[model samples]
Target: MSRMRYFTKVEFYNYRADSGGEKAGYYALIFFFYNALIIYLFGLLMYKTDFLERARLYYSNEHLFKLAIYSPIFILELAPLLFLLRSKKENLQSIGLTTSNTAISILLGIVGAIPFTYQIILDFILHKKEIQLEGANLWVEFLILFIFTALPEELMFRGYIQTRITGLIKNKYLAIVVVGLLFALMHIPFQMSMVNMTFMDYLITNWVYMIQLMVMHIYFVYLYTRNNNILVPIISHTLIDYIQLYIK
Candidate 1:
């Protein structure tokens, strides 16, 4: 093959369409571990460097810092995968993204967000405390949340991780559960930051919330799997985050 064709070949990534389920299962393990290591290393680096503390001290720069922290997912996961797909002349739909039913997808997102929003409202009413909004403009914050946070995350978890695992396992429901757990585990750093307790104490106290987040992950995964469209999960995920930002 020519040099250009070399990289564009779908087989270049080692994902064979005819591979046995056992092979796919092995690939899933490798993919999960690679992503987990990268994400954990990024989190550890931030902690060691006290980036979160700096963001708190220089509250005006918090948004910038947040972007800096989240950049790793793009650099390590999303970008590479996207490049490989593009090289293959593959659209996102090759990995289960579709827009044939855009209206229904959007409506599903809105409907799914209702209960989550209600829970947030209930928590605010009970606690009489809200998340602190760090930015000057709600619109700007919304864009940041959707672009930097929601887009990358959905692409990583639902688009790449869950899709790959499901394809590998040949069991959509089981893949959702597995990916959901991973999603919740990935929130550990954020959870620790939000709570003032010691690490162990925080984990203990937040166990219930973590379970809730895991279930929510399943909901988002289901949205994606149901329609084979990532946009729904992205919209639903972003809506939930936007509500959190608004309340803060």
Candidate 2:
């Protein structure tokens, strides 16, 4: 395969026998809206309501709370794709789940992650920040970050959304940017809750960060389209989150 390019044409797997650009675009919009709604409602329940406090009364284990939030979202994100696959008799590879380009994909992922990795190292040296795992369960944290956060996200955004958009838009760069914007927008509610910011405040104060997120996702789009392998972006996404969570 040739080296990946920003303007390179993106190839997509045919999830449906009669998959046309218009049809794919329609389903993609539906999936995006569904995901955004789920996230918005969950964020409201977690932060705006007394749901977490009420739940904490019964479940003493703090990990359960994280699991409670992530597990359901993960399942919800994967459900539509799973249902389509089962009904269509399509295999996992239909969403770029195969290990066909495992070695190259991993290499590219690591290569793409180096700059952020260097920044973490620099922070450690300059600020003397201590690297520590957030919880006692190291493997559990890794699994949760990798399986729940990274895998489903890459599968949804890069695998499904980007693929469909690439088909709909002739300009691959435009398609990737559109997916990047959607990816960034999806995080707005959750980020607002984390920072205790109102929607307007978030847009005003964190617009730069939002654009950076979009750029970061654009790279993820490049990674996925580069090798036509979801693992490329999945590995990079997991590694970046792991380092930020554990190291920084």
Candidate 3:
């Protein structure tokens, strides 16, 4: 077997350190980089090698490269979280409580889908983007797209990674910032330089998406803690994505 090394807090160094004496961060690095490599290779296989065109969080077209990019990551997400849950049971114990608070929290989550819904709506109303409705292939395409685009992301971002990291960090707000940034980082390879004219443009663009993600993560984690199950965040994420799809 091969051993792995990690970088702490997502930074590079001239000297070697043990990533805070733990390799979890390295696993995250590997997971992320592996996905990037897969996206490129799969794009080649599909002859969609024009990866430079996408400068946003998602691709405009559906290809096998994308399908491969997400599903495996989503699958691996569950394993790390489950491992964390067992080994760090004490740490995770306080996260989500199965209490009566679940009801209110869940309601709040459904309400919190407004921002993206609003943006997508405005984009359509202003004709910034063409709105597709009732096309013979629309529903089918959407369902397939939604499953790959939304489900895997919500699963990775909200379902597993965020939850485990919060346990490790033991701070909700900090964890949100960290994981939210990661959620943004995960999108960067897809767009690279086009998403940002410079690093600042990219950071700012990602920051908007990151803020929305952070808020959603906080809200879902709130519900999870109140309700005491992973399902609340999962369902909340799914609902939000559904609204994003339908609103435009």
TM-score to native of every candidate shown: 0.70, 0.84, 0.52
Each prediction's RMSD over C-alphas, in Å, is 6.4, 4.6, 9.7
Error of 2 at 84 (Å): 3.2
Q: List the candidate 1 regions with Cα displacement exceeding 4 Å.
A: 1-25, 50-69, 83-90, 119-135, 189-205
- The 10-residue segment of model 1 with minimum total lDDT is 1-10
Pairs that collide, model 3? 96-225, 97-225, 97-228, 98-228
Question: In order, what lDDT does every prediction score?
Answer: 0.65, 0.76, 0.49
- Global lDDT of model 3: 0.49
Instruction: Please write out the lDDT profile of model 2 over residues 1-248, one tens digit for every residue.
Output: 22111122334532222445456666787888899888888888788889878877877666777787678878888899888556545567656777777999989987777766778968888999976965558777777888888998898888778766654666767777888889988888877887788888998898898898898888887777777778888888888888788876
**Which residue pairs does candidate 1 place in steric collision?**
131-248
Error of 2 at 49 (Å): 1.6
Q: Which has the greatest lDDT?
A: 2
Better of 2 and 3 by TM-score: 2
* Per-residue lDDT over 73-97 for candidate 1, one digit per residue giving the tens place of the 0 to 100 score: 5678666667645755556775545
